[model samples]
Target chain A: MSDDELARKQRRRRNIAIGLGVAGFVLIVYLVTILRMQANLAAGP
Target chain B: MRHKPGMRQPVAISSMSAPDVAGPQDYFDLLKPRVMSLVVFTAAVGMVAAVADGARVPFGLALASLFAIAVGAGASGALNMWWDADIDSVMARTVGRPVPRGVVPRAEAAAFGGFLSALSVALLALSSNYVAAALLAFTIFFYLVIYSMWLKRSTPQNIVIGGAAGALPPVVAWAAVTGTAPVEAWILFAIIFLWTPPHFWALALYRDGDYARAGVPMMPNVAGRAATKRQIFAYSVVLAVAGLAPYFVGMAGPFYLAVAAALGGVFVYLAFKTLRSGDEDKASAKQLFAFSIIHLFAIFAAVLIEDLVALHV
Candidate 1:
């Protein structure tokens, strides 16, 4: 209803988006590590 | 406008000073998603072409590397926006960008760009190989430091030499997959590099006033429109030849060659039309500008499709 309220809402939404982005990055790193290990194992020692 | 008992006082919405709170979309806009999409597409085509050439790249790794490349490209876009915000604020085409519009601050853009550049390069190295990482770093540096900060203001030939940054995504992806950038990869790069001048000069022809106002030395602002048209036609001739090089080098099949040749022919024809158009007529330049986007996209898409069919079907 007001400028202050709108600003707060935007900030809250931005924080949530950032949280999700960080979580996504962590998931990607985990998946990449697993995939790389599998490839290395398939290639043999 | 009078306040009654138990009623709130009227507040003028226009006079209300809105706080500077940027949403995630503003930050995403800083990344220049359009350019990121182009980078991802061309890089994927490069990876697929390499795969077709017998370079064994796992699908997941390819996807991860592509993500890194996209982020790296976005980082460059952010940094460019950060540096060019002043000029961008005056240009009609760029005035709506995040930094220029005040949705995002320039310093924040620079920091965000710097952080993403490092993270993307590291991710590429970790997920793929060092060569890809190095190429991504170089691309970011070239776009930010060389093109945006220096050449962009100093020379009319800015986009000509600066096109290398835009052209390197495919080469980087090829190196990511094969650990070496072969001639085929450079042919892809050459196609894009040659396409840049004609593509941008056409836009400059119509937007010379915007460029002149921003004090940027776009071809039409530095050289007259006639000379810019001549250069566009000249570059279009070479681009047509470069577009067909993938076939001669055996990187693509007959279907690709046919599509490329047809698209290249039309590209040159449009450039010729633009060249012959009267000085005050921007219609031809506008048509050429619009077609150049399709020309580049279709050529790459044709190569990608042919390679994909060869690999799967």
Candidate 2:
């Protein structure tokens, strides 16, 4: 493969990694929010 | 070629050309994953210890907080790499790190670190208690601003004082679980803080040339080898004593006490061996350096096992 081709491939991989990382972060936030809400709700007003 | 703080120095380049491919792995390397692993282990032990002590935290929350803590640690590692890039290039042990090797730019490292620092702290607050988040923030700041940027280049006592940052993860983990870091958590903290000096000074003893060439003032470099040996032995003695505090404080049972005493004895003996070895001998230093890692790991593992047993049974 050409140098430019290798560079483009690397960039694509990096973007994919970033996308996955962001998705993972969002999932964690959602889970945490649900968990915290459950705990607070279980505690009552 | 001493790296003066606030002075710009050129990075020491390897004879090999910088890799044109800057991949995700290079960015991951910026996190100092090995160090992050230790942080994760110690912090997990802290969380388990808190649970054993009657702290009621959800498993999911605990897991999330641990992730944030790991990210916070990685952020600090990235910032340290950013600030120490110049000296890192000089040191044989660190010459291949991402920034120094030119796979990652220094500014990018700084930005990455800063972003992760904020993200980790904010995520921790959302996932855990404010106390844990605050401690995480302080750990990052202490490692980056206080240790990496300032004390690392300035004094021989750098590791001794800077050890606090490395030791805080467990305390932060305890706070995440309990929302309070009581004496039990502090006992864990104390064990790691004391363990730091001897562990690092042992490495410094053997790697004196790397540190000297890099112009970093490690204990062996700033103080003579004999003095550094003495200090290591002294800290080892104290560390041995501190290692027993968990049992006394009721954090662990007799099993932990037995394991801690046995490990601490060997640690002190190794430190003593390193002390008694000829000035030119690197063998003992190398042994002590390698054993110190196992020593700390075994002690914490013992505590973690005992805590798990207590929590379950």
Candidate 3:
């Protein structure tokens, strides 16, 4: 591959990593909230 | 005829790229999750204790208040990391933190911390009582302003006075249920207050070089090791006395008293060994630090268990 293509691929990989990280964090928060609510329901009167 | 030649190089070494910068997880690590867990657990115990005492706190409100306290504690951790990132980078124990590691920018950390602080306090006020909310705000202020900004760098007596931030969680939990600070709540506060110095100083004793390298004025760093050891012994004695106060005040029962007494004895023995050990072996400090966590957890756990037993029997 040309040097220009290599640079572009690297940039793409970086962006993909950043996107995945942001998505994962949001998913974790959503899951935690859901689990907490479930536990609260289980312990309810 | 002889000719002389010189070599020329690029002014900037562009090939040597900066080490891969840390990402979001690094910043999260700086918030001291282990410490935050203990704070959250103790705060929950405080809330449970209040409920067990017939304060009539709803479970939902109790949970919300606990969440708010946890967020506030996280905010304190983030803010401390933001401010101390410079020193943190120099300390072995703290060098891997997000802010220091460049995973998260300092400005972002500060903004995130401030946002959490405001959100937590506002939510607590809405979900719980204003007294609880106010105490939460004060706790954040104490940790950030009093402890982190001023006391940490200014004096060897820093943690001694600043331990109040950690000590207030139970009181905040109590106020959430009762809508007022009671004498019993303050007694619980005193137990944690006296417990903080000795527990933290033990860690400081073991990590004295880290504080010295970072230029932070920890007790062992500012005062000599001997003085720090002596203070640890003194604080342990005070903590043991304070731990028994809950029973006398009728807030806890025989179970809690027995657990507190046994744990306090061990704590004092460890502190005494830490003081007398001349081998420079930090085993006592390490043992005391680790057990101190268990000690606090057990004391609060005993409180909850005893209350449950009383209600049933």
Candidate 4:
């Protein structure tokens, strides 16, 4: 690949990695919220 | 060197660089220190009240838990600045904020928020009950995700509902010592929750143009000034009643009852003034906005003072 093409490909990969990282972070948050709500419900008044 | 027909230009690297070199004050601004101060004070009140009520929280652990809660509040502020930089840039009141001025990079703000979030929750868990730590974590998540990302852009009721996150600090502090939230703690929560709408809507009334320019769906922008004023009045009335609830519930004494009644009366009066005043001047709106802050702080201070006085008597 030409130098410019290689740089473009590298940028694409970085963007994809960032996107996946955000997705994973969001997944963890969702799981935590779900667990807390369940626990609060179980300990209900 | 022909480009594809539909290709978009890549973002310039220099454009992504921090726009202005920030001083220490910029970092302080990132915390929204005024708002954080209220969170810290109210949380501390909750902690002291819990202890006064016969909960035996160790001094060291309580101090650590308070610090963690403060950091959590700061983290939420930072994340808010990060997400709302665009809107902040356009609003006169928020134009000088660190992120909007580019004194802080958005990514750095996000990373700072994430780091503080993790540290706060971990420290809370280690020093206090896991339930408190978990509540703190959820508060951060609710403010940053639900309030900032979703509700803020989607609806005018954002502040009304999102206020729950701010209201949770006292409950979390109570749980830190007692290992559970009680009816009294939630009454405190409800007071703050109901108080938020009138407080925020007053500011929204004055900053309606800014919100409209920034495309934020603040009540005044989406629902018109008259409707927003009426809602503010309604919420102020509800908040006044809720503020008086602690005294009725036997959680507070005569001093608290007197202070709450006086403040709530003034607040409702201010709300009514704002409703009656012409939208052209905006003076009443501004007055109500300033008084709302004092109203909340004074009420909390009264609670602390009343509790101490009751103990002495």
Task: Please report the candidate that would top DockQ against the real structure.
Answer: 1
lDDT of 1 by residue, B219-303 (tens): 8887898899999999999999888889898888899889989998999999999889877549989999999999989999998
lDDT of 1 at B238: 92
Clashes of each: 0, 0, 3, 0
lDDT of 3 by residue, B1-313 (tens): 1111321211111121333343344545655788789888888778777877887755656777787788888888998888877777777787767676665678978987898788789767766768899999999999999998888877888888999999999898889778988888888889899998988899998998887766667888778889989999999998988889889989898888899999999999999999998658388899999999989999888887887777677
What's model 1's lDDT at B92?
A: 80
For model 1, report DockQ.
0.73
Q: Cα deviation in Å at residue A31, candidate 4?
A: 32
Going through the candidates in order, state the TM-score of chain A alone for each one: 0.94, 0.91, 0.80, 0.80
Clashes of 2: 0
| Best first by TM-score, ranked | 2, 1, 3, 4
Q: For all the predictions, what are the DockQ values?
A: 0.73, 0.66, 0.08, 0.03
Candidate 2 true-interface contact recovery: 0.68
In candidate 4, stretches whose alpha carbon ends up further than 4 angstroms from where it belongs are A1-45, B1-19
Tens digits of per-residue lDDT for model 4, B1-313:
1122332222212222332454455665788998899999999888877876778765656877887899899999999988777667767788778777666788988887888789789768766779999999999999999998888877899999899999999999999889999998898899899999999889988878777766778998889899999999999999999999988988887889999999999999999999899756389999999999999999999988877776577
Interface RMSD of 3: 7.8
Give me candidate 4's TM-score against the actual structure: 0.81
Considering summed lDDT, which 10 consecutive residues are worst modelled in model 1 chain B?
A: B7-16
Better of 1 and 2 by lDDT: 2
Q: Which stretches of candidate 1 lie over 4 Å from their true place?
A: B1-18
